[model samples]
Target: MLDQTRRGMAAFGLALMSGLAPVSAMAEDRPVIAAAADLKFALTEIAAAFAAETGTKVDLAFGSTGNFATQIREGAPYQMYMAADESYVAWLAAAGLTRDEGTLYAQGRIVMMVPHGSRLAADGSLETLRAALAAGNISHFAIANPEHAPYGRRAMEALRHQGIWEALGPFLVLGENVSQAAQFATSGDAEGGIIAYSLALSEQVSRLGSYQLIPADWHAPLNQRMVLLKSAGPVAEAFYVYIGTPAAREIMKKYGFGLPGE
Candidate 1:
């Protein structure tokens, strides 16, 4: 069962591009939970702990919130959804797809990250980014597509607040989601980018680059929210409740998510 859970978790993040096949027939007993890409590391740890504590498992698929919203509306069989923005959950509720409006899970932030040898300064003010752009030292700057990902949308807002949105346009390279944005920022193809603070905190991404948090006031609040779909069952409900537990909240904090109400 542990092996199966690992496999399911591993495949969930890829389900978007795979046409949702990875989660198609994952154990009927293990409910599928669609999550925002920023929650990948934190929620993965939380789920493992939940499984260990309860002897039951849930599958989690991480991707762009807007894309997940579209999938849920299209009847994707997801029992739960954790969106990086509360608006998406509210939208699902309005569509009568979710059990309720949903619970506020966490608040998120963005950061500017640059790889080891980049000309960019990884400054939260984005002034350095503007300077790099003017100097032609920035080849490509990574960001998730603002059309779908909440973090991406916030990134765009922050850049706009910094007054560099237009000039940076010609050098932009978008990732499908924030996690992918982090990858691109640290990869040699791009000099740097704004990505989820949670992703930048992860060891896997941080090892390759340095990051600085953007000001919270620069963008609208990233009030993350989660909901149980109408298709949710007992296991999924338990997992949803478990996310509010102290253990889970700690994991979220460790991954750079600001806990709700705290």
Candidate 2:
């Protein structure tokens, strides 16, 4: 009798494996979101909380906003785009690529960062940076590529505002994006760099160096925005709206972003 029972169970298992038996439905799909490099830390945390609440997953790809915008225009298969600048969303909207005008999510800030123990004083002022550069103590000052990275543009603006853009030209090391610029600063590849305040507050970056916030008036506002692409699915749409919720805003705030309307 036991041998017969074993044979019966084996037959049932074989039938299931061979697709001869009814099976449960496949799991729901996760939407892909293309986001700016400056959103790396904050969005990751927000996505996790979103997943925990909704039981849906969101896959994020972080890079320079301009690159992502170009890729979106080229049909990169991303369901949504979150940019460090609102202009990118407006451009996408004008191209008829987005479902709507999009939403402003957060405002970001930039900072000057140097590896811990560097000669540059952490005085939280550009004059300190100017003095270090004049002393020849900073061999390379890194920043995101201003051509495609908003942070880099702001970095350049700040330097120009401080009257150091011309002098720092010879010592600049440009990264592909803000995150890479932070990496350059942390790795000591560049003696100092301008990067997102959010990244500077991240534990990974905080351990490697210290930063001083750049005056907001030095550059254009970093009004971050997000949009659902024309091809966005239900998950993407839900997540897009979720970002405006209080929970999501709080997480962004924790990461150093100024919540919209605050």
Candidate 3:
């Protein structure tokens, strides 16, 4: 009976110790990330894989880079910021909102997408776009709000470059963010959309549609940049470092993102 009593006491003590450990010390701590909307699909997969490998959790907030910048400037408590354009990250860095210098992570490309079985032309060039609009084959076209979304701005630039901006003006539908624009297209409310190539390659999208890559020169390069915030913890720093690993790079590539030179 005494031996059994001792064993019970030992088990109780172990349990107590386990329960007393600091929550922060029990697992790899996660950081709060403010990310651009175009990175939705890829970032979600990347974040999940990162947590599985390192036992860290990632709290992600997705929106337009401009909106994120405003939130960060207003003290949103983010430990890192990933912007669709380098300008926003640079601006935040210049304002001393970040720790280390900003790093260019990826270059995003634009694309035109339509529902999988839609009768729209597959070429998706400027001429085909105009022809489709004239034929009334497409009623509405969605785009991220150019006021905030870099992708939206690029889409506008592409339209203007093709000299069809005014002609398509009446049919343009604006979404609050790039992801929302994609939702508009995917839901069939809009016949098609201008969205990020990364999002275009997502399984959810693949099952619903086909996409055509827009010419690279249609607008300025969509240079994505990531910055470590001044309030970032050690774990956040480690996660940032992990983003540069070959494994992460491979994952990025699978989602249609290209590295600096590629």
Top candidate (TM-score): 1
How do the residues 144-189 of candidate 3 rate in per-residue lDDT, one tens digit apiece? Answer: 8888889999999998889977777777777777877777665565
RMSD of each: 8.8, 15.7, 15.4
128: Cα error in model 1, Å = 0.8
Clashes of each: 0, 0, 0
Candidates 1 and 2, the one with greater TM-score: 1
Residue range 1-262, candidate 1, lDDT tens digits: 0011110111112212111112222445678899999888888899888877776778889889999999999989999999999999989999999999999989999999998998888899999998887877876888888889888889889988988888888778777888877777887667888999988888777888899999999999999999999999878877888898888889999988888779
Residue range 140-177, candidate 2, lDDT tens digits? 77788888999999999998998988888877777788
How do all the candidates rank in terms of lDDT, highest first? Answer: 1, 2, 3
Task: lDDT for model 3, please.
Answer: 0.76
Clashing pairs in 2: none
- 249: Cα error in model 1, Å: 0.6
Candidate 2, poorest ten consecutive residues by summed lDDT: 7-16
lDDT of each: 0.83, 0.80, 0.76
Give the top-scoring candidate (lDDT).
1
Query: Candidates' TM-scores?
Result: 0.89, 0.88, 0.86
Model 2 error, position 37 (Å): 0.6
